[model samples]
Target: KLDDADLKKGLERSISTDIQFLIAGQNSDGGWGWWRGSESENWLTAYALLGLHEAREAGYAVPEDRLARATRFLERWLTRTAELQDNATLDTRAFILYALSESGNGDESRAVELFDRHTLLDTDGRAFLLMALDNAGEGQRPRVQTLASELTARAILSATGAHWEEQAPDLRAFDSSRRSTALVLRALVRVQPEHMLLPQSVRWLMIAREIGHWETTQETAWAILALTDYMRASGELKADFSYEVALNDKVVLSEKATADNLSDPVMLKVGIAELLLEEANELIITRVTPSEGQSGMGRLYYSAWLRYYLPVETLKARAQGISVARRYEAVDAATLESLGAAVSTAQVGDVVRVHLTVNAPNDLFYFTLEDPIPAGFEVMDPTLLTTSHAAEAPGRERLDPDDSPFWYDSWTQSVIRDEKVALFSDTLPRGTYEYSYLLRATVPGDYNVLPTFAYEHYYPEVYGRSEGSRFTITPTAATE
Candidate 1:
């Protein structure tokens, strides 16, 4: 994120592209779904609206009419659900409150009512409620402070240190531990910076560095956001400080952080106008605290943000690099008529098919794609998958089948238990590729297919995901 003065000149193009993507994907009734190819939901719409509001605050030109329509959609949904005695989930209500308040669309009364009705006392739910009340600007500072303190009291201290748990005993527990900690930390930092819990949680975060880079996008984003906000709110420096910025191990700028300037973090900014940064280059920011002890090593606080400058040439090159697509299809063995890109219904023992395509600009040293077969669905002939590759350049060969894997390795078994089909390729040549697999429905109920992910070995940061899919299973053929 750039400063206010640099908003239009620095990140305007990228912000515009993201805003357009959200606008184009909005549902016709004015709500956005949690994922692509899904029906609108309350929580997802609120998240999208939150993102849109942030962009608008940064001076992006978001249509006022679109926001109005979205507000109407949320109001209607909430009113109808409440009338029908169908209470909204805590997560949905919290997000709706934050979104509506941030966007200046509605009051906080309904959200407060919904939150007071539920007493789950879970970490994620409680943290979100704290944030929702703070954002609502309802003069609930006392309530917010109390909630943060209560969360702090529930935290546990192991041999390692004090850290918050997910408290979600299901599949999400492992994946959400770091995320829950970050959310609670954010709430604490926002409401009561002077509380002792803030420093304890910060120390725990510093000690538990292994949980720093989580795999999921949301966890990583929240972690970064929480840490940055904490750093900014950490009050004045008690000791002398020196700050330095370097690019590729070469010093570019240095300054002393004294009581005069360090007292207010809002005025701090490190300009990089002269540095000619390129892709894949490292940037480092280091702050040094002098030791007051006789024999000791001084403390060093290092916080670095990736630096990327997108001029016309670099942008054009990125456009030609890589592309991937994944789709769900209902197939008919006899007629072969196109059923649809989405599967709506399935009976017991019915098989569902998935299609995947990838286009590579260069020979990929390693590539892998994985999808979780839903609980009620079983992979039919997991070994019966097929792959086809069209080489774009001569002498560029496909990966050897032996080096490729057909299913997920145990690496992620702790987080996900559903059987999934996977495809891996090493030394896959520059080409367009396609693959397909089958799964048989055995149980009877509604199920949502988790998102599929594609990863590149060399550039681990670069990845892609399929639009999430869902289908319903009936107990008998007559039910369908």
Candidate 2:
């Protein structure tokens, strides 16, 4: 229970720090910038406000003054757009309407006038407006309900469409004057939360991971947060990892601050955490974008390596219970029922769970029915038994194929030789994925039986192929 408080305290500290960046981001035009300057961008201002609001809800202590200023910036921008007759800007209109709707300004004269009946029906604008209405508890209105059904239908059909080619709404269109279809997901996920499709925001994140773009620890952190948020909301897990990079004994990120480009901005996620990181003393990402030169969008790590070590070391400690925290292994769920991480020595009647940031292609990671392992949990191999030996340990009973009838393998004709090497290979597909698996205590044993990865494939060397991790399963007798 206290963990929630502790996490909240940390989030508050982060929220407190992020307010400055967003405030400083306002331009002379009364709107925020993509970073700190260039222009008073309305879209950036809107997203910044949205992000800060989310932070506040997450229990981050965002300042009321900052919120007021940001809200005013949005209001002014909306008022200016209406006066100028440029209400066709899908992203801006949607955002402004959302701001107005969410703030109880829907009944206000300005908001009533801003809701354009003609353009509200436009696909992009309609989706965005619906999101605002939904949040405003006005989605039940005839117009809002119609759009909601339409989006829910789109979300359902997302699985059959030409995903890579079909263009969706792009929020990033406001920036760099280019249409980045990635933003469409922001609207889709918000309005159709119950639908099964994976959010595009998550898919972009998954793409980033699939491409191994998280070389620096900064990239890794953002990716973790984004993936975690998407997965948490989706009510399912992505069985595969979009990307994985090797970690040497050195720091996980570059020593110097990164350079940003128009193609890749200094802030990728566009959230309060990104803003908090931008203000840090040392940055996790060192590759600067073009915006960094003028906008000052890079983020830094305060403790240097402490944050880097937290999640990773937690994972390394699971095998022997070296760390009080839990570490989950990554499991591939191709053709399998539902594969998750395991705690060693766990029994048939316990619940095994995993904690991970995942982005499956769509809703590929979930099933309508519960997995089949509930009757009596039997680990395929707590050790992920890649290697086998005929000789049994002093306490381990001999396997005559009768006692170990559940055991599987390549061929029974060939006499088993060595238990020292992997029997077969589990090929990872070409795309990238990030995953974590854990066996919960309800699955039954006091101790965990962790598995080990035996194969070795350099991740940094071959970005085109799959790489696997290994671990050892030590059965600690159940304490209860």
Candidate 3:
């Protein structure tokens, strides 16, 4: 909403309730994840802190300890990542800067230095980058203005104004496309409110179906916030004109606003008025002007605004995160040969080997890998889990175990009742861990092996799934 809107007491209460829910979802680590019950993520934690800051500024009661812990978590994250010098994605860097700026922290300057070293290609990345730079400080305004112009230049104009392609070629992914458009519109409007593209973008947004009530919370929130600010700034909400309210073609009330006499600006507190509002209502406003012919000509443009609130009981918050893991399946020659079976083809009573590999690019706790033993197969021996050396990547500098004693050990556990095999570690560093297990085929049949999933063990949110492999077990030939 807008400051001028003077949202009714009821609406304000609803907003307050939502804010409380957001505050309660903060993780024990003083950070927030994308969804409830999710492990702390830097960007999500930033988003939560920003919302809390807004609520606190708006005269709402926010716990000081919550904010302090979140700030410390963010500062610690920045220090650790910088020391590692890992190749951080553009979105991550932008979000970190945004968090620092919005938190009233002095480290925003450092975040700005990190943000300046990259060129963001994705629309989401660039839009957030602009937002981060804007919040970074007054000193960064010049850069923000320049980047806003660059992004505006890249926007692809359409019949409905401008939109962004998903990547290079795919323009049909309209959800993400619209989200990007909204994000860019927000950024550009902040830096260049008078830009020529404003009307086209605003017009396109206005005509879209349920533009303000998008399915995704982020899209909906961004759209509503952007449009409200734009409309308020443009003076489209003037209350000087006469207005009347009606329901089902029946007149309810009429008033002629005298803008000069009113102390308040264009804001109208219509919803709070005593008029009995129905499930649906229509309002009409007319502005009259004197013409050269000495006759008054009236031009009427009707605009309708609706506000809907869901009962707190109906709102359910979910936590979300990204899982990263890989699977490598191969027959264990040693185990198979121990049973005197051929090495190339699997048969009844032959041992099958599976090597589940997890790539932990980010710090993880209780990182878990879960593999379901395929049907018709039974565990032949204990599981083997080990960590030798982390996989090397192009730009990542792998931490040496000798240098940093905080290394992870892989441990395997099998639940016989659930027929599931799991490998987990207490603290997984930014590297790779492997889990291998052997199972003996008990029946001769072709089977579709289910995919194995791996995720952060604390939150248990899946990050990756293995590509399933199929194997045919042959019946042992009758002895001649």
**What is the lDDT, from 0 to 100, of the residue 269 in candidate 2?**
25
- Per-residue lDDT of 350 in model 2: 35
TM-score of each: 0.51, 0.37, 0.49
Q: Residue by residue across 48-162, what tens digits does model 3's lDDT show?
A: 8888887888888888899888888887887767634323444455666666666676465665666565464356656667777787668888778767877777778889676
Residues 51-80, candidate 1, lDDT per residue (tens digit)? Answer: 888888877899987888788888877776
- Superposition error at 429 for model 1 (Å): 33
Clash count of each predicted structure:
0, 49, 6
Residue-pair clashes, model 2: 49
lDDT of 2 by residue, 359-405 (tens): 11221110110111221233233344531232121111112323342
Off by over 4 Å in 2: 1-15, 25-30, 34-39, 83-90, 100-124, 152-192, 196-209, 212-234, 237-480
The full ranking of all candidates by TM-score, starting with the best, is 1, 3, 2
Clash count in backbone of candidate 1 = 0
lDDT of each: 0.61, 0.39, 0.59
RMSD (CA, angstroms), candidate 2 = 24.9
**Residue ranges of candidate 1 with Cα displaced over 4 Å:** 1-10, 34-37, 80-88, 159-161, 169-175, 206-212, 236-299, 302-480
Query: Candidate 2, TM-score vs. the true structure?
Result: 0.37
Clashing pairs in 1: none
**Higher-ranked by TM-score: 1 or 2:** 1
User: RMSD of each candidate?
Assistant: 17.7, 24.9, 15.9
